[model samples]
Target: MEMLSGAEMVVRALQDEGVEYIFGYPGGAVLHIYDALFQQDTVNHILVRHEQAATHAADGYARSTGKPGVVLVTSGPGATNAITGIATAFMDSIPMVVLSGQVRSDWIGDDAFQETDMVGLSRPIVKHSFMVRDPRQIPEMIKKAFYIANTGRPGPVLVDIPKDHTAPHNTFPYEYPKKVKMRSYAPVTRGHSGQIRKAVDELLKAKRPVLYAGGGVVQGEASQALTALARKLNFPVTNTLMGLGAYPGSDEQFLGMLGMHGTYEANMAMHNADVILVAGARLDDRVTNDARKFCPGAKIIHIDIDPASISKNVAAHIPIVGPVKQVLEEMLTMLDEQGEVGTDTKSLERWWQEIAGWRKVHGLRYETNEQGPMKPQQVVQALYKATKGEAYVTSDVGQHQMFAAQHYLYDRPRQWINSGGLGTMGFGLPAAMGVQFAHPDAVVACVTGEGSIQMNIQELSTCLQYGLPIKIININNQALGMVRQWQDMQYGGRHSQSYMESLPDFVKLAESYGHVGMLVEKLEDLDGAMEEAFALKDRLVFMDIYVDPTEHVYPMHIADGSMRDMWLSKTERT
Candidate 1:
């Protein structure tokens, strides 16, 4: 065994974990750790302008690569600033390990400078929180952090390390744990055969069935199994916001997203389905709207790795707790042995006709003028066409996020990333940077709005410094579009502080950061601008596209409203 400082142990442990990049910002409390990190050559460090952006960048890296993203930050405000990012990752079930510095062990509870209760503050949002009391426990804690963060129902894990642990005199031999064993944390990876048989029996017996999938399927890497199951049964599939790319959006069986801003046909199908097969999706309020009235005619079958999520929100007739991929594989094998007891062909045709009627009546529609300011929908459509639906898309929370969700079609898991559970603003830019870092050869784009882009706009410097070719599409409406829409619909259009009185010129802002910037005001120039942005292979591009200020997202289901109570557009009421 070799002697090493606590800081050296931390760096060595990270190297053992195969950590390639660490997104973070340093401070006085973490100076020793930072120095250790500087001496390391295997791990690359990205210094983000804000601690929040650092977490987001790590989250993006995790989402895109299906690995536990690592973050390092100082104590006090640095740790606090990262809360939003941590909460966002937790809500979305993204795997992340956040390492924050703490005051010296001797100064504990003495109101030390930059000292805050990191464990208490983060307990609510993190899957688990730990404060390192002994320097020897650092290696073990690091191992546990990664294990917990990437295991069943993956989420962010926080570890607070005291400054004293990194003292020069403090020494411990470094050795990475060969395995992690948590007595109470073993996750069930296989579904019970009896329950799988029961679910398959129900699916074969039902005539009008729907598969509602969520991000859990993506997290489990079960898209292939999910696709096989859907195709074999010839069932229509609808995804939640987080589940967009679980099923190919171009497939005829795909019914688009199914929630508050879901497609008309998707919502209608859910309301009318006789059997609802839920795969890796939680029945959140946004999807259910009214729990009592949701899918009144359906018998629900929920499959998830976490047993607590089985029937917590909505009653599940058949609840199967296991990994999505394994469960789906088992179900498919059982169905094959049973000789494919498919649903009635005539009944399915009739159901399809009915769903087709709804699609024709309430399809996604938007108005645009070729000579006027570009519509947000038009810009998104243009981007989709320009990129050929191959770019990794991230979005900041607002109407622009909804528009991106609606217009862009994702055909694979991890292609589309957004703040679904937390709806955090300013998630786009940093997330895009993370995605770009994960897939340096692939195109990455961040679709943001005027209001949300300013939250972490300083990250543009990070992009420029790293030479990351991330495309930033700002839908400039000069207002908090989503809030304004709500105010217009629910608050008598008072507008409040939603409007941006002195919005900075995005093109000029991009130029200041030494990046290419383009402005598109007219609809006719959108395609050309998008083409130009896509052609730039080396430099970052910022496209500030002007859109209709008064425009609102359609097919909106307000709180406490049923799927049938959707508002089609501004001119149409429920």
Candidate 2:
């Protein structure tokens, strides 16, 4: 082994893990590591404007590529700024390794400069966290961080390295381990045969069944298996917000997204189902508004890698704790072997007819005018048509996000990436940057609202500097559209701080960053603007599409309300 500095060891460890890119913002504390990074040519470092954006970029990189995203940041405020991103990744189970530089070891607990309890601050959000007390432990810590972040239920992992540890003279020879085996960290990969049998038995006996899939299926790489199971049993599948692309949105068996702002057919299916096969999805409050009333008549079969997630919100009659892909494969194999289970074909057809009726009556309807003030749904639909549903789509949290989810049909996994769990407003721009970085040749787009776009709008410079051809679609409504919708519905339209009195001309802002910018105010201009944006292959394009200010997401279910209690629009009740 060659003698190395802690900073050098850090770089070496990253190289050993085949890390090609690192998103980070440097500071005084991480100067040595930055110097080491500067000397290295194998790993490319992306300098983000803020620490939070760095983590978000990494998260996007991970989610799109199915590889663990790496992030580097300084201590104190740097680490604190990364908390929202860390929590965002954690809540969605995205694999990320966050390396943070801490204050010197000798000054521990002395209230040193640029110091914070990184471990304590991050413990709750991170899958695992470590404070590197010794420089020799750097290799092991880095390995553990990556392993924990990517294995089992993928999530963010933080490793805080003290300033003294990175000093040139304080490190020992680096020895990277070939493998890591933690006795207590084993994750179940296969479901029990007996449990699988029971789940199949339930599916065969039910008259009306629904398949609820989530991000876990995407993360577990079980989308094909999920599709096969849904098709073989002739089940209508509904994806959670995080599971948007887990099943083909265009499939006839697909019932669109479920829960608040979910499809009328999907929500109705859940409300009226007799058997619910939930795979890789946690019944979060957003999906099950009132846990007690969620699928009241359904015998839920929950399958997940994390055992604690089962029955945490909605009760599960059969719970299978295992990896989604493996469990689904076994279930499919068992079904083929068992042959027909005497399922009622006529009853299933009748259930589909009822679902079809709901779809026909209340399916994703929106109003638009060709003259002026284009609807957000129209813009999204135009973008989808322009790209032919081939681009990677990321969305900032708001009505625009819901509209994108509703309008754009994603046929493949990893094609639709967004901040679903944490609902971070500033997630889109930075995340699009990451997605573009990961797939430089692929078309990448970010759908953002007026308010959410401003949160990480500075990243446009990052895009221009890196020459990332990310299409930024700003759905300009001049208000916090989702909050305004809530206020309009719940608070008698008081409109507290939801309206933006003065908003920047996004086109001029894009031009200021030396990028192409286009504005679309009329519905007729949307397709042309989207086509121009999609045709660009060299420069980043910012398209500010002005939408109707009063537009709101529909089929909205109130807090603790039943799935059937959906409001079709502001003035229409379903």
Candidate 3:
């Protein structure tokens, strides 16, 4: 075996770990890592305009492909810029490895230029972090970082290496460990039999039962197991925003979503349930409007891989800590053993009838005038039809996001990728790029508002350079839609600076980047324009549609209000 420099060793380790691409920015302290990267032709690197976008793109990559995203940045501000992206990934349970260059080992305490205590700063947001004071620890640390980032609930991990250590001599041998050892890191293999039995008994005895699913289903790849459990038990299932595609919306037992903007029937089910088998959901405040009154009569059985997530925000009757897939699989097996599982046919029929009536009464409908602005719901519905529910749809944070979540029907898990926990605005375009990069064969769409798209518009360059085929559908309302909605409803109809004075021709802007751009003015133009956007191969396409900014997402739980106070419609607010 040939010896290699510390930097070279890192490159070799990354290649060994199956990392094909790394998103990063170059700087002084990390020049050696970049130099080594330049020498090796195997791994591809995409340079982002901002360090934050790099980590966010990495997060999007990891979330889309179920692989550990790799991000590289230099000292101080470079490292700090990556903090938000890392925190986003941490909160969402996306696996990523953030490698940041540091000041030289000797210059660390001397307040060297571009120096910062990166490891300490990133500690809370990462699953694990390490500062390599010695070059010999590089190989082990890299191996351990990958293990930690991919295992358990999966989150970001940081590896900080000083400038001197990057060029250390080649005496250290490279041995990739098969596993990592941690004293406090034993994950549960399966659901506890007693706990699963108790949960089954609770469900069997309860008159009204609801299955609450969350992002943990997608994060843990437990969608199939979750579906099996829901179907076998014959209970209606409702998902949090992050858990949109976990349960099929068309399923008889499925209730659309549960939150402020969730379905009326779903919220009613949560309010009246005698027991809630909360699998993979954390019961966020958005999901549980008034925590004290949430699921008033229900005894919640909370099952999650993260022990801290259980009973942290909302109390639980039974907390089972285990991998979601494992717990769900075990629960399914136990239910099968109980024999002849069937739904409360009469209760289920009544529930479905009520939900169907609610659906018709408050259906997502809008008028198209063929002249002025398109309703936001109309834009989403047209796009949804054009894509045929076969695209990896990612969104930026805004009214468009909530609208897409509420109106769009995603058939399978992992299709709806967006910032759920953090609600970060600039996440859409970069995330869509990352998603396309990870799943090259799939048709991917990035849904964002004009305000949100401007945050990281430079990613268009990355898409062009990489030849990533992405369809960017911008809801160009020329206003901050979400803020405008809130303001219109609560602020005495006084429209503030939410509307911009002048707007750029987004089609021309895309053309400036040598991308094929299209604009739609009529309801009928949507399908044709989307078709053209999809027909273009090996290039990015941009579709800018002007939407009515006055549109607002309803059935919302306002501050200090119970689920009973949900607006439920455009004409009502409690």
Backbone atom clashes (below 3 Å) for every candidate: 0, 0, 0
lDDT of 1: 0.92
TM-scores, all candidates, are: 0.98, 0.98, 0.96
Q: Write the per-residue lDDT of candidate 1 for residues 44-132, one digit (tens) a residue.
A: 99999999999999999999999998999999999999999999999999999999999999997999999998999998899998899
Candidate 3 local lDDT, residue 129: 95
Candidate 2 overall lDDT versus native? 0.91
lDDT of each: 0.92, 0.91, 0.83
- After TM-score superposition, the amount by which residue 384's alpha carbon in candidate 1 deviates from its true location, in angstroms, is 0.2
Question: What's the alpha carbon RMSD for model 1?
Answer: 1.1
Off by over 4 Å in 2: 340-342, 370-372
Give the range of the ten consecutive residues with the poorest summed lDDT in model 3: 359-368
Write down the TM-score for model 2: 0.98
RMSD to truth, every model: 1.1, 1.1, 1.9
Model 2 Cα displacement at 409 (Å)? 0.6
Per-residue lDDT of candidate 2, residues 366-426 (tens digit): 7766565778888889989998998899999999999999999999999999999999999
Reference-based TM-score, model 1:
0.98
